[model samples]
Target: MRFWLLCGAALAGTMVADTASADTLREALLQAYNVNPTLTGARARQRAIDEGVPIAKAEARPLVDSDVTFQQNYRGISPFQDNGRSISAGATASYPIYAGGRIKNSIRAADTRVSAGQADLLATEGAVFTETVAAYMDVIRDVSIVELNQNQVKVLETNLQASRDRFDVGDLTRTDVAQSEARLSDARSRLTVAESTLTTSRENYRRLVGLLPGMLEPPPPLPTLPQTPNEAVRIALDNNANLKASEENAKAAGYDVRTARASRLPSLSASTGVSYTDYLGTLDNVTGSAAGLNPKDAFTDSFFGLRARMPLYQGGGPAARIRQAQALQGQALEQVIEVERLVIADARSAFGRYMAALETIESSQQAVAANRLALEGTRAENSVGTRNVLDVLNAEQELLNSQVLLVTARREAYVAGFALLNAMGQAEMRDLGLDGGTLYDPIVNYKRVRNKAWDWSDDPAPTTQATRTATPEEDPRAQGPVTPPSN
Candidate 1:
């Protein structure tokens, strides 16, 4: 219909005007990667875990401490009868010569735990990016659907007007006019629903991307896909963060078992100390003896020795701990296997969905083409009196329905492709080519904190002054939202 043609042209013009300010999927994802609180928190948590390595290593290092003691003694029943003051200061150092490998195993366990934390951070990043991609695509898909519904409403309105004209001239019955009116009403209602869906989709986009969506450009194609489901599973097994984390945990648990067993073995250490004592006043009156009865007024004593300890008895606690650790290690190992199986299953399922979506897109395309031709033929036949207004309206409705399905199928295909990538642990900023900002590397923080002790200034300084405007190069999509054209 001419009305439909005009509507399409107007919509095209609106899109072109909005495209100047459009937000792209890549930009949205980049903003999310840079500002998402959950991902930042995960990085912080991993840094905290990295400190455990130094804490465990400290047990194998020398410990030095200083103590000062002061005391006043009063004799007899009166405060002034007899009084003496003594003060002593001492410094002691102890170094563990051997701990039956307990400290070594503990350090190993801590290292593995840090590795696991790093993997957990990677997993969190992937999840956040995956969610951002979906939110970005959802807004674009919903907006397109709304446009399609609006066009349908226009086409039905034109059909209803034509039906009314025909009925007034007795070419069509009143019942036929009513049918056209009822279909138009239905189309309007669907348009309202579609608009509501678009509003919801925009809200979701804002929640993930840290800004409300403007005119969204179409999404880009997904990254190169795996050749087969087996290939996808292979990729997932190799790159999946959850599986890596679980494997590291299992290693840590094995070290814990060793640590617990070592607790029951003998430990050897060496210690040395020097002490100085001073008497503030005579103590003869308090002791009822000579003025320097205790010893020299000022004296120093030095001593050094080796100490050995063996856990001879602890109510069977050490043995029980070893058993508990063994059980925990077994559990961790099983978890690793479980995670691998789940990852494989998820990867295969995602690939299947992606393939199905591609097929649906093809089917919907064919349907749209067929229905468009049918609508044109129905309109021509109606003009020649072979088909009526109802046939034209029905054909138009079929075409509209096919268009809706096509748009939805395309959206699904894109989302499913990303889903497959996510399952294979490849749905991240680097893989998506979303180089909009500085990429966060968890290793930078880990290396800074892993060997640090009693140091808070080791963290990297901010790159820029507290207040400054962003440079043009820093934000690639500063002009507006810009998504790639839909395939």
Candidate 2:
């Protein structure tokens, strides 16, 4: 019974461990979208922009103000009798009847500003995604190199042992034993460097994603390539967030010019007010009788008025403002054009990189296969005394180098694919198939929180899913292990 209970407990523990270890690349990306400081800061800036919308809209609404005063006097006043104490309260309301479209133009400018802010947020997200993908690829490449070096060390050690045995039997020269030992030492040194590099890459990945790197899973397979460079460029031009932001800024500048032009026109407004006053102590009336009034028994008076004002001249102020706005509009227009050109260029560059990476992967795969065959042949020849130990060691190193190159090329290809997606502004969490519903959509969350529609009191507890899973058949290095290799 004791043995059975222990076995059952061990099995449960193993299952819990497996569950904890299971994660996917998509999950990592969703977590990053939620917790990345860059994304959060961008969203905060966007909310600040939304606040401008209400400020602009308030211009068309009525304005109200109130004033109250209380005074106490000990000495008598000669003019109209004496007031020991007095209290007065007044309120005023004003409404703009007309402003020569200045309010409308200002509101339009504010709207444009809000749009620009949204675009800016999107642009920031694109940049963050690009950096994350690059860091992820670096981790994968470095880990793969470390693994390759470790395998190389093992191969060299085996060769050194064989050489020592052969020398003991007088079948190999002392020079061959020395060469095998030297190769083994070189392999160990390379392994150490590779392990250190892998550690640094893992830390960078962890920092970007806001999680421990070991918890992340391998990224999804690369998508199919775009058929033509023009197609890719068109996609980038149409969808690139930075390009959109530039266009929005240009539109906002145009609105600013309109606002400046409108400021030169006339403004009209209407206002009305009512007030009550009371003498809290004794006051002498015209009949010489003392009249006492309390704040509760105040006399009421009412009046209404309309106001009109026009901007005639202010030292060329309006004209200067208009000119400044016009200059800014022109600068914004130029920026839009520049962004379009840049987006197209980025698309072209990413497409070229993807193509080059594809070619490299193909070439490296071939090289790895060829080098493996050569290493095998050299080992066989050394065993039969036809090839020296140095030949085996050199062949093993070549094979290891080829494997490292192949892994690096594959990772580069994957990264370039992501780069192309980002250049086209299509590299969202959803596009990466990381749409775990936990993926942060700033716009949606902003609307919910800003509108006071989110129920903070009843909010659900935050939950997270594992972002990776281990497969028994898959090598840790191939999937990009986050742990540093043991030297």
Candidate 3:
């Protein structure tokens, strides 16, 4: 007989009669990557941050504005009054020539923050992917547990019927029957709990993967693991997305300080514009036949000049801004060190847990083997009247316990391994080798909008990007595995 009952593939589809197809771990990760709401929102927020670069650059670009005005006056108050009707139109244009590095520094700060935002987006991806892995494995683990408990219930049922038969034949006592009945009842209760846990896990899977999971293939082995915990920590300090984001934030803050200081310096700009006004015969002083002026005659005004603004005093506002930026820059620098500490701690802890879980799995496998042998021996002795029914019953229970422990340990090992990878910054989409579609590149958006100048250009209206967990599979039991899954 097989050492343990293996979890089988689920039905091909949710429908009762559909062909069978199994869901792999890769598929779940891909689904979450494409449409998980949290990750999608992070990407959207990063895109918004990218716009800041262009917004900062715009401060130095030419600004053009135009205006038109129509007026009517009944009272003539000298040559300046246009009583009948008059229209005015004018346009103004200005370009910043210099700002003591304020514009340049501001753009640098925004671009650095964009880098920080991209790092934040990467962290979000890693976080969401980590959760998806946990959720996916949870369903698999719970399903295996439910199946094991179900098998236990069956075994107890067989024991109970045998106990009653033996008692009726005067070979076993009524206490033996009672004991079997009690154990069977307990196994059934445990089975209920296991199935309930399985249901909860399936709901979580649906939340992340956009549907209830079917049979899930075993996850592939983790790659590029560091040989030592110290190595893992070193890698994490260098590559952890959270830490990188903090460092980028610190760099951005430094740029902000420079930008603030530049504010106190004088700024120069060029201004050029044209203005026109039509009297429309309303200026009677200039529109009459005696005046020798045409009703259509208009005023044309043109000007070009350089503007220089030097701040002598501003109520200490610019100084305050500079000080505030300096303070924030220090805070950002401290945050980088703090994040580095956390990354180091996480890398070491995850590595320890993975190692411990692997050891547990090995030990539990041995226990399961020993217990199975013990139960077999106890049955043989009971058949020959050398051992009591209680002894056989105890052996069977021990084997079931060991089987459950082994399954749990296997689950723990896989999860811990994945967690270790995540802590070491090796679990994002690029490392996942997903062929589902093109990976999202934040640079695509940054490049698209960093120099955007069209005032009317805009993206399509935003819609709900994530799939709703509508009508999720209510009963996970119906999709129970039928054969062992391939890793």
Candidate 4:
């Protein structure tokens, strides 16, 4: 009980020590949102997906091309030997008049897929934030446990010395002294384990947040939560990113089926071109007189035409493609349901854990108080010779255990609550009110690139957005000797 009370006071003091300068949950999340490699990579991938829309739309636009050809004497197979220096230049332009809906459906599918990619990017953001929250809470929990364990080791050390003095004065036995020493040793070992856990948790925090953690302010209060698991499921089914992405994918796949079916229908296009050819006075090199041969002869030609194509026999490929697309559309539709189920399960499970952890925290607090009183009573009774040293030691250990459990329960409750929010699509940047910096908007990039047709436009070279840090030295936990110290 003293440990818990001390920890509470310590945390309060820490919070007040430098509230303005202290690192916060929002700050940590913002760092990750800005530079976390996983989130950045997902954003880049979604941007690439956005280009699919323009690429598909390109099929419906006009295409213009130009070419020039030059011929030499060695290429002449006719008696017009010096037909050599002839040059031909031409330009052709074609515009789609109709495509049996293939181009339209393809563009629709690509556009819908861009929506799906946006949803996927949203999902990735949520997942990374959840993981960062978990890691933050883990470090806090482990730090508190390490502090408690260190305090216990100190208490046990004092008890061990007292036991030794009492034994020297004939008030205690060797067994009593040995028991105290053993407990102190065990407490020291546990403290070492707790420290190692803290180090590992810090490393994980750095992995997510792009820097080593500073003095982390306690997490802010969670948003209002759903009252029941079924309510949570309802919310998740409506808001879950994965489910939304899957739904869009199913729609895109349906469009793909239509695009494939369009292959059997006749397509029409308009084409026009102008050509210029110059004999380069090759006729002047003619060995014999030829009718209408001019010293310099050149001709210009122009034409306009329309073309229509229909698939008469494609070796059953178009039918197979249609069937394949239909099956995939079915698969995509099924995936939506599958993801919905997962979201529901995740929401309910997280809610259960949060509730359970809250109860454990309450119980552990009570247990801590009880064990604290028990330890005080046992120590007084031992002083009066009514209780043994072993009983007092056991009570102290119980108090420490209860305090550790209470801390852990609180951490778990916080993490689970955040996870529940994540599943419900309420743990994103906008949801968290993280005002640390500008939030990433996938739509801005999507809209900018989706309808672009400029051939000369270019994007800046991609540079890594993630931050780098020096790796920490090898942890003692990982570098210790294989064998235990001999007793």
Using lDDT, give the best candidate's number: 4
Task: State the lDDT of candidate 2 residue by residue for 311-399, as single tens digits.
Answer: 78889998999999999999999999998988988889888888898898788778878988998898788778798777877888788
Candidate 1 — which residues are off by over 4 angstroms?
Answer: 1-18, 76-82, 285-287, 292-295, 455-487
Q: On residues 153-175, what C-alpha lDDT tens digit does candidate 4 reach at each position?
A: 98998899899999999999999
Candidate 3 pairs with clashing backbones: 8-481, 8-482, 8-483, 9-483, 12-19, 12-20, 12-21
Q: Which residue runs of candidate 2 sit more than 4 Å off their true CA positions?
A: 1-22, 73-83, 215-217, 282-298, 430-433, 438-487
Q: Is candidate 2 or candidate 4 better by TM-score?
A: 4
Full ranking by lDDT: 4, 3, 1, 2
TM-scores, in order shown? 0.86, 0.81, 0.88, 0.91
Q: Is candidate 3 or candidate 4 better by TM-score?
A: 4
What lDDT tens digits, residue by residue, belong to model 1 across residues 157-209? 88888888988998899988999999989988998998998888887776666
Please give the range of 10 consecutive residues that has the lowest summed lDDT in model 2: 7-16
Superposition TM-score, candidate 1 onto the true structure: 0.86
Quote model 4's TM-score: 0.91
> What are the Cα lDDT values of the candidates?
0.79, 0.73, 0.82, 0.85
Instruction: Say which prediction, candidate 1 or candidate 2, comes out ahead on lDDT.
Output: 1
Runs of candidate 4 exceeding 4 Å displacement: 1-21, 75-83, 284-292, 471-487
- Error (Å) of candidate 1 at residue 125 is 1.9
RMSD of 1: 9.3
> Which wins on lDDT, candidate 1 or candidate 4?
4
Candidate 1 CA-lDDT value: 0.79
